[model samples]
Target chain A: MKGNSYLSRKLHSLLGVIPLSLFIITHALTNFSAVEGGSERFKAAVGFINGLPLVNVLELFGIFIPLIFHGVYGLYIAYQSNLNTGQFSYGRNWAFALQRISGVITFIFVFWHVYQTRFQVAIGGITHDQLGMTMHNIATNPLFFTLYVIGVLASTFHFANGMWAFLVSWGITVSPRAQRVSSYIWMVVFVLVSAMFLMSLSAFRGDEFKEAAAALDAIRTIV
Target chain B: MAETTVAKKSIKFVITRQDKPDSQPYKETFEIPYRPNMNVISALMEIQRNPVKDDGNKTSPVCWDSNCLEEVCGACSMVINGKPRQACTALIDKLEQPIRLEPMRTFPVVRDLVINRDRMFNALKRVKAWIPIDGTYDLGPGPRMKETKRQWAYELSKCMTCGVCLESCPNVNERNTFIGPAAISQVRLFNAHPTGEMNMEERLETLMSDGGIEGCGNSQNCVRACPKGIPLTTSIAAINKDTTKHMFKQWLGM
Candidate 1:
């Protein structure tokens, strides 16, 4: 805790605070775009992302780094916590399990996403993305579509959840009144965003688009 | 029953009594003569000694829990005059005539004033809101916190697992499983310690989990309701920043 004078826990939080949120918002916006433009528009957005000259580096950081840090940091905290805290009661220990599980799910969702969209590289063979082709594939793949829906729902929930959590980490979720208000807000927003994504997937009709559609539907319907 | 009947001046009570948790709770009336500057608990104690209702029928002694009458134990908490607080500390002189007493509904009632506080305790466990320490073996000054820092650390340490905060939180209802604000504040407290920081990321991560910190609705009631005046909202905000950073750190491998 005392290693660097400049880097207290507050600073560590600041490091991820903005960027992690940015990722969620950007991701939400991009996913929402699917409703207006269909797969083609989504791909166009993808094209826009790929064309940015210096953006891939940022995108790479956006895509990979935060996930690693947030998820692993969560695990490390959980691991160390179990060792240190006493044999805790139910309320005390539930968060540790829930956090790790959500982390793992989000992590898996990302890899599966990369592979399905042909953005995956290194783990197997590098799969390049032809924007239009990727778009077509998503429209054509039922499984991918289903996953997208789930991903969207999960992502929004995660973000909404993160909002309340971020407050606490900053030493802010202090008053019971404030905590209640913030959490209720998060709950409402999460459900709304997730529902929007699900509606889109469900509206997509056709065998070719069934998987993608199902994914979207799943996102909306997930309780 | 009349032999043990303690003389009373004239105290009024509008009690919400229920035969069962499912039974539609109804108001019952009682007027025990007032003793000088009596606490709400003392009045209840008098009622327990004489199981007679205002209607003149023998009934069971009113069931409630009270230990350390000083309120540190928090067992004497209940809704008096429509506000959640310690009955033992609620002076009869300050209360309106026909004082209203009801059980704290945020928890399941085992009897009249005794409600299960397992929910709050469970939340603490969920957040891993403690620093691990081995048995007392002269671990001798494991870590020294600044007196300045200890001031607030001690602030958060005052939570007595009372249901006041949870009861005041609108989000913490039957519809949602949101762990109320107390546990969130506790997370901030434990994570701030030198040894406690070892699990900081874990605490942050837990807040990120479903029915975890996400459940907080930020009504700011907990701070207002906390008898110890713990800063519940501030802890939530701090945890918010911490968890986000923790998220990005995990993803970025930072």
Candidate 2:
């Protein structure tokens, strides 16, 4: 019997590289645009994305499908595997365990985020500065601010570490030195991306989007 | 209180049994007269000789696989007292009873304690975990490796294909086609050899394929489960690095 289940493994890796990672990196960078470019750049970017033809189909096929697959498949893998970090406690072992843990957190964060924001805009008929106002309101709340920070960290860590794993498993970075180089690069990515996400969140904490958020709050109160 | 003069000197066992590969497995209890310094294998032998259950009914001998009566063969590997290891080396004195013996469920159980370890062997085959030899004639005194390299390679060569590592591994399940740690480690061993480097690309390519190295979730269970203390995770890391380099070479047509 051919014992090797190659398709699932390849698909998981492929999905991580393509739509999943691609979407995540783009999403993070776009959100980071709020750091200096203000709400106009952020809203413009969101508008551009929302203005695309077949935006619903593009999201369902290009983003949601891949994200759900990668997230769910990753969970199944984590479930089947035994954690030995408690016994072995090596750096690589810890990294392995942390990857799954971060994956779970990121999955939850991403889902909750989309539910609170995306669905509200798409299905709930809430729009016009939806991204800016919603995020600003969320950050103003202490509990949600903490969650947003954690979500940012978790997603960034997942992407950065996942990139290293992707390179190694795909036979890209084969030498110890190369693997180390990739590790260093990914670590840099984690820090920079995390800082960018935090800075964007911090921008929301300011009064720049206060009017938009207060308008939404008044609408919510009246409804 | 009434005092008893005869000390109860028996070992209790709760063994998982299946009459055939497709049979429904059930637990069968056995109590055997204890002997000092006896291991699980010896206790099993006593039960085999008696062919009787703890309830005084005659039954077939409790079946398991073992050879060399030592930890080397890997045939004797099973889940003893909840840990996967060679039963021959699991000293009864050290284990808590009633000892539980179960077949390594990672592979198909043949009958009772005998599991088809073909998965592991096939994985080794998949990676071509060997140095290719042209003929039976003397290829007299092949290339000598450095002493330090030979020492580590010898350690990697100690794997007996026992399937314990696979049993402990979370990634090696029915749901996935991971080749497991043993084969990956073996790839490292062969790739380190002077002659083996000729087939290095082939081996690396095999690992780069679907059920290959990418399947590793890095649980770190295999290293702890290896009876020979082989640096399995280390080998995996090394091979992971090597395969990427090999892919680069292949892409560059070097």
Winner by TM-score:
2
- Per-residue lDDT tens digits of candidate 1, residues B1-254? 55686555688888877667677777777878777879988999999888788889887778888888887878877888777898888999998888999988888877777778888888889889888877768566777788998898998998888888787665577755567888988998998898898788887777676666655534456666778888877777777667766767887999
Q: Candidate 1 at B78: error in angstroms?
A: 1.0
How do all models score by TM-score? 0.54, 0.75
- Report per-prediction Cα RMSD to one decimal: 13.0, 5.9
Q: Write the per-residue lDDT of candidate 1 for residues A45-123, one digit (tens) a residue.
A: 6666667787768866765676666655544333322210122223212332444345556667766766655454444
- Can you tell me the CAPRI class of model 1? incorrect
- State in Å the error of residue B45, model 1: 0.6
- In terms of lDDT, the best-performing candidate is 2
Worst 10 residues of 2 chain B by lDDT: B239-248
